[model samples]
Target: MEFLARATGVVGGAVARLRRIGTPARQAIGANPQIPQARPQGIMTLKMPVAQGWTDGRLPICAPGLRVAAFAADLDHPRWIEVLPNGDVLVAESKERPAPPRTLMDRAAQATMRRVKAIGDSANRVTLLRDADGDGVAEIRTVFVQDQNQPFGMALIGDRFFLGNTDGIVAFRYEAGATSLAGQGQGLIGFKPHGHWTRSLIASPDGARLYAGVGSLTNIADQGMEAEEGRAAIWELDIATGKARIFASGLRNAVGMAWEPVRGTLWTVVNERDGLGDETPPDYLTQVRDGGFYGWPYSYWGKVVDDRVAQDPALVARAITPDYALGGHTASLGLCWMPAGTLPGFGDGMVIGQHGSWNRARLSGYKLIFVPFADGAPSGPPRDILTGFLSDDERIAYGRPVGVAIGPDRRSLLMADDVGDVIWRVSGA
Candidate 1:
């Protein structure tokens, strides 16, 4: 099975490259389907299939009560999405590094701090909107605030929106028509940024707990875990109190997180510690318990210790590997459990967006999969429900999914694609 998997990787890459070059190579491959396809296969097209719109084949369904809808589109580097109590979708429509809106919030003396210059780097403006009626779309929307560093996660409690940028977490008020930072900015997290910033987040089912994921401080921290370096970890804090702590530790990077509705368990799709050759470490999705330690700089996936952080024989015994491991280097990202009988083989399974492989020679991921999750836990091997997003052709992708949100209807799945710069709504067949 390992040999066959390797063969799959080899052939998949050749086929992808062959898809790039057009002509006799293509004809030869077309004549011999078993052989790898030719390069530059075809032009990748951007198409968004609306719920009832026409598509090439069977359409994916939302859970019976769920339906997909576009909250917003065409923004700059949008990363996070949060819906408020009054039916407003707040978007972290991020500005680029050295973000220009640094001084926008500096009007007050208290807001003027030297570190604000550091905060100035992420200044991605926030956008807030309302559907007014409970329609599955946004009607009246406007820019809410600015000056955040890679604002990728958000938590909203009474009268405040706690935004998570790479450097720290800041709070804002969610007035329906207000267009600026309404309250005094309070910094809740203090991490010196050396660029390991993929801060995705989720709240406890009850809106009381704000769970923030801080990626390793560096790409591969030279010092390692003692300092909370490159490994991934989750931080839990109270919205009202503004106090926070490291909830769990030693994750290479958990970019996607959600609180399972049924179990009230905090779960995350982790981007395992990388640089292990090509397919050495597997990414994972699992229930995260507070104070529990998962192997990071030390061991991984239950048994394969990284050997980077020299393991104390006793520490290896104590590490917690993932509950379910996706195939190695799959780049698993945004995830949403199947709403209902959305996908046949995967009834109420966990639906994950595999963002595709970047550094690997073989092309994997790029498909939305349904991993059998029963009673709030993983059951079996993941099933591919939304596949073929990347056509047989090479050249370009329509989009790379970043966020997956279940709708108010509770049946449709809403996916935000960063590459295509579009939000996709996939409903049940």
Candidate 2:
């Protein structure tokens, strides 16, 4: 078995290298990306960097005039972050739940996941980080909530706290400065577990509703549409009545969501479907409309049909084009609004954490980026905020940024580096 695994890795690595020989740098980026026609391949491209953690206090390189430091360290796979009213930061520490391998592709994917340190038993907990002295580093670290089913998103509304577990939203009674949750939580909304399992939650501006992102159970609904009935869409849950309804549909993997303050519109960064060519159907950042559809299986990029899926003409016609493309296979996930003046030389914009990609021969999105906003829309090309997560040869990853949030100070930025097991803080130098 060991010899076979080694042989598979050698073959896969060689194939990946050969595919990268003439691959051009990514072109599908910015507000008007040149999206190429899809070229489906019988064998999907698979390339992932081996995970090697940071050493000797080395940190990610920040953009000029900005500096980064470890705000909190030594946590288990922290995937998402939330800041409380009292300046406490909450980190949701969890990982993907490994599924049993049933096919050759599945077995290969599992092996790749293990090689990249991407698959493991979830820690199933949320930890609190407190910066009591107003320094960038967190002085207090404690487990706030435990035994969760892969909790990823958290929201505090009034005295009630809500968590987005893999299976549902759970509510708990919260105190302003409490270190840990005291009682059992009540499940508010139930959802199908696993298969793009990170449930990202954000509170409505009015605080009467909560929006949760539930990803599809299978890529392109290959498991059939019935299995995807309530997946691949954001659900709006009424806090008072616990009634939930689908807010928007056809978002393949809308992981990060925030409100664009200028226009009062909700925005999200979505991870597009795979199996198409490296540059096909670029992942996007868009203003999410209340009942709008943005094609998933039927079409992509506003009615551009994907012949792989069973067609639905009516649905395709209604598909909305995303506002901006963040490059293909970038895995743009974490998103947070940064008001003007939060970071030096950076005006009001959205910050995205691209967790990097594995489905492409040449890598894309292994860094933190910022997209400037004007009149509540993306105004310019993305700017690299932090980089150097990958090694010079691109064979090893030092870290992968996941969830981003504004620090409680409202000046610094906090990012969850799942692979590095650290919460990084970025501030003006």
Candidate 3:
């Protein structure tokens, strides 16, 4: 079996490379990314970069006029970040719980994960970092909350702190300057876990409700729609009443949610369905409507039907088009609104942490990006905030950026590098 698995992976990689030689060049990105014809391969592309962490004073290269340094290091898979009112930084240290392999494809996936250093027992904790002297680096590091089930998104509403665990949303009592959460927490709502298990949470401006992003169970409902029930959509949970409803449906995997500062509209960065070739459907950033639907299994990018899945013509008709495309298979995740002047030379925009691609012949995203916004939407092309996460040959990744947020000082940008186990701080040069 070991010999067979090795042979299969070698053959699959060779086949994927051969197919990519004839694939069309990718089209424009950002505001109007071109969607190409689907050419699903018999063997999916699997070119993952090996996770080789940073060493010997190595650092990610930032865009001109910007500088970056490690704010905090030696973390355990730091994936999400939240800034507290008292200027304390909360880092969610967790990863996906490994599922046992059941098939050849499953076995191959597990192997790939190991190479990329993705398979591991999750830390299941959130740590607090404090830079008491207002310096760029953190001097204090301590576990803030622990023994949770893959906690990701976090938001503090008044005296209650809500955490989006893989299975549901849990709320704990919070004190203004406390470092650790005292109780086990109360489960507010439950969600079907595992498949795309990162539940991202964001509170409404008025703090009346919390919106959680729940992803689809399979790539394109391959496990049947029954398993995808109450998923592939963002749910609105009323804080006082504890009632939740589908805010919007057919989102596939909406990971990051933030309000447009100018227009006060809710926006999200979604990870579209995969296995439709590399560039068939682009991941996007768009204004999320209260009761809108973006195509997932049935369609993509506004009624561009994905013939691989069962179709629904009525639902396809109402599928709303996204505002901007990040690129195909970019796995665009972390998103936060950047107010004007937060970083020098950049105006108000959205900062994205593209975790990079695993199932594409050519890599797409492994850096931090800033999309300029005007009025209320994306106005200009994306600017590279930080790069050089990948090596010269693109075979080794020193880091993969995830959650992005402004630092407590309101002048620095903080990003989580899960592969490197470092929280990087970016500031003006």
Candidate 4:
């Protein structure tokens, strides 16, 4: 029995790889994608990608004519960043809060993540970095916000600054050139926490409203819709009144969001459900319409119903198709739009931080990609911006990128590598 089990395991691994990785990159992107559902979860033990931190004299690979410099290092799990108006960068050094493993499956999953070093003690602070001499490296580093819950996203509007803590959104008063916030922030609104802790924030062009992207409490609504109340949707809040309402719905894990420069539409990078083999449903980038449903649990990639989910047929019928697919299990967390002239060779487009994969036998993401926009929509295929996060053999990783932001100078791009604990600056060579 033991020998038979071992042989079966090896055969299952090979089959999973063949089913997951054969799709060409071109066929996996754009308005339409080739999504092939593999075996559902639990048939095989989930594969956990190993994390091999950067060795001596190593850096990420950059595109030709582009260079990467270490903007800041020695951070405790830096996951998100914001560029201030004065060209200062705010880095959120945070991790997920520890909760009791409620089920056997959850405990097993936690063990796997701990082995991969995916979970760290919550840093609960935001650090500031400033390149005063116009160089790529930041000479000044200070604690901007500290002693908070696991903070993720940040935004600033005039004198009022907003920070998204795991359970609530907080407001702070700001002064130009100040390194740190003076006191504890006032909580503006509270939401459900624990599941999908990253709450990404962005403000409107006119600064009249603030938007927060809150991910679902569980994958595929496994805990039922009751547990997902006020989750898996973007909330639009009035800056003055502090009132909030859902802007969009059915996005499983919308981690990063930005406004398209030309069309002024809100776009988001979503991490879709897993367990349906590797290539079934592609994680996507889409223009989020108000009150729009992108089909979570019930269906995916428009109207392809997921047999695993019990749903109201009515909900699947209303499911809107995403604009573009970013590949399966990529965990595309960071999204930013680059204005013209920010970098040479790279014209107007969006920069994404793919934090890499963990479900499939083969690894995906773990690099920065640029999707060029022709008239406010993603046009050409995604171009490699900075790679080499994985080892030459692709079995281990040097780091995983989580958040991306264009520097306030409008020339450099800042990437937060959570596992490597370094912030990389990308500029024209």
Judged by lDDT, which candidate is best? 2
Q: Tell me the TM-score of each prediction against the true structure.
A: 0.72, 0.97, 0.97, 0.94
Worst 10 residues of 3 by lDDT: 1-10
Residue-wise C-alpha lDDT for candidate 2, range 1-429, written one tens digit per residue: 334445556766777677676554656988778887787868777778888979877789999999999999999998999999999999999999865766787777777787677878889999999999998999999999999899999999999999999999999999899999975599898999878999999999999999999999877988899999999999999998889999999999999999998889999999999988777878899999999999987988888999999999999999999999998889999999999999999999999999998877778899999999999899999999999999988888999999999999999999999999999999999
Rank the models by lDDT, top first.
2, 3, 4, 1
Please identify which of the two predictions, 1 or 4, would achieve the higher lDDT against the true structure: 4
When sorted by TM-score, best at the front, the candidate numbers are: 2, 3, 4, 1
lDDT of 1 at 90: 69
lDDT of 2: 0.90
In the range 90-171, model 3's lDDT, one tens digit per residue, is: 9999988755666677678767776677766899999999999998999998889999999999999999999999999999
Residue 226 of model 2 has an lDDT of 94
Off by over 4 Å in 1: 1-71, 95-123, 133-137, 175-184, 223-231, 341-346, 391-395
RMSD of each candidate relative to the true structure: 11.7, 1.3, 1.5, 3.4
lDDT of the candidates, in the order given: 0.57, 0.90, 0.89, 0.85
Candidate 4 matches the true fold with a TM-score of 0.94
Per-residue lDDT over 119-198 for candidate 1, one digit per residue giving the tens place of the 0 to 100 score: 22343667775667755566677877665666777776667667877677777665654545664467777654434565
Stretches of candidate 4 off by over 4 Å are: 1-27
C-alpha displacement of 340 in model 2, angstroms? Answer: 0.7
